[model samples]
Target: MALGREYFEPSDGERAFAETGRSGRSRAVQLLLIAEQLSRRDGDELPTGLREDAEALGTPELRRDGSDALRGEQRARAVAGTRLRSYDAGLASELWSAARAESDPGAAIDLLGLSLEDPSPYARLSAILGLLSLAPPDGSTSGVDGYLLARLFDEQYRAPNATGGLARDLFDLLNGPPGGDVPRIGAVPPAPLGSGPLSIGVHGTFSRYGTSRVAPSHKFYGYLGEEFSPDLFPDETRFFRWSGRYSRHDRSKGARDLPLWLHSVGGVGELDTVYAHSHGGNVALSAAADGVRINFLVLLSVPPIERSLAEWAAIKQNVGYAMSLRSKLDWVILSDLVAGRTRGARDLLAAERSAGLDFPPEADVHTTAPLGWFSHSSWLDKRVWQSTTIEAEVRNKYLLTHPGSP
Candidate 1:
């Protein structure tokens, strides 16, 4: 029987397998199914290695399904894929630059409209950021083409993809009234350190967007609990809740507030570890860069922005041990890059050709090549937390080991 099919549309046997174990071929089959789905949805060719694996494993069902998906994608691509394929890295950069440079709002809107049409997802993201930059404080995109703005709003409403909610948030930022109170920084009073080491969790953008607090039951906190089991975690675990706004201002403020919050409940010295996901990693690193000491810092799918690189030395010095876990399929980081560029920060792609160079030399970077369609938030999945790969890296390798152990 094809394990991939059973995994996707599980029968009693598949359900029994899931309850029994999640290692070896079972995990592989699941990953293959995920990869096939991603290829079908994203219109990208399946990687050769995965294709070979499917063949070797003799998963005829997966092979047939993947082949059919690829053929269907190819047919669909004939009409729309050409435009996306045409926008190479150089062309996408040029489009973004042109959009940024245009002084006239109307002309800039036109350039952004063209960028939105590009095949590259990054180019499309740049266009979204461009629109955000052009919009007035009151959130009006007046004089801009109504259809383009309507499409953006429609994406916000429908959220057809992962980035849809992000587009919605950006739209809300443009049209929503401002004047919310600034987040308090350095006001947390210092408290006594209790027994055992303390662990803190910080969430990424949109996790608590426009919200004043993150509920105790948020999935982020649950993921952290799974990552750091009760045996490893202190009795009094804390979470650093932020505005979750995807802006430089909010991130910088979060960085400053993290250290102060640490100070409030014992001090950075009392902290055992910090597990930050997505842009929350940026906040953690930024705080470390500013001389906040941490025992262990685990970054999950964090974007390697230039700002982090610039502060590499400080981060390395202050952090006892740093590890970054990223998925090969994470497009959210790419979107973060565009958002960073719109806010006038330097681009990482401009400085380094690969994601490996984004971190400091001393920091341990573990890139996971899961054979599935995982997204930015997929890192928080229970299956990911329990996987053998994650167990090796996060549990046995890092968490169980002493700080600074290789």
Candidate 2:
């Protein structure tokens, strides 16, 4: 079915099933619900296997009662199925695991496509990552169905949000020529650092999919440079472009490469500050953990994944000063909690904190919610940059001060 439909409310039986602690049975119900939802969306009758499973599971609420009760039964069944498919965290985790484990590319593609409808942003993010993983190393889209490719593009245009933009870029990569492999550690040589304090911008994940110059994240970096460079930084502002892929492997490589690149330009001591958003922040922190001592670090909505806690903790020792700007309404980091459950413990302990991630005690934390900036990308907004509060923080407090003066 076309995505972005209103979420269905769960019935008493469905809620009871979830609370029963029968994980195996719950998964079966979830699959049945997903099958039913997909079948109905495709204008097809309910599949026999799903119907049989519903009967076997004794989930009468998920089966059509009778012809006379068609409307009510359909509603109940659909609601039950939608709840299991969309709202169940365990189910979402299972979907990701299944997509990763599936051997057949075609089956894996179908599973990933279904996962896009999940309410958890992590699941949707995983789906996009799975698609990229399935793409041919040679950059050919030969095995993928043309209709599915078109549908993905349609979803991208319809949503037009962060995840949508990511999907669009992935679509471009699938359709276009191979961009070649991700760079190795130290592959990118350091450019000349001009005479004054240097400020560097590193963009978040999915940014490397399309042209680096025109990406929204890149544009945001450009805006920051133009808006603040003249007064805040007398020297030069530059962007450090990395793979921007959503994987530990790529991020670890970036962490190593960032230090190598900076050292070539006279090390992090020469850097006045580094501004990074989302996973970009992780890269910077990971670099600090690897001994890149930074004068200042500004993190925008970086997720506190369990694997990155050590890097976050390292900031106190490796960074002279750190500032984190976050929005309370940033759902992307919440997705990290949901998706991280599959990996291990959830890193962010509290949901009420800035960006849902905990920062070191030495770090300065600010929430954009009071400024009416709620979206994950609100920090990138020109209005946020222009606000008096942010002006005081960035211009007067952080940037205007000498390096290491928090």
Each model's lDDT: 0.47, 0.47
Off by over 4 Å in 2: 1-80, 83-161, 164-195, 209-223, 230-238, 263-269, 307-313, 343-355, 360-370, 399-406
Q: How many residue pairs clash in model 1?
A: 2
Model 1 / residue 187 / CA error / Å: 14
TM-score of 2: 0.49
Candidate 1 error regions (>4 Å): 1-150, 160-162, 170-195, 209-238, 266-270, 308-310, 339-364, 399-406
| TM-scores vs. true structure, each candidate | 0.54, 0.49
Best-fitting candidate, scored by TM-score: 1
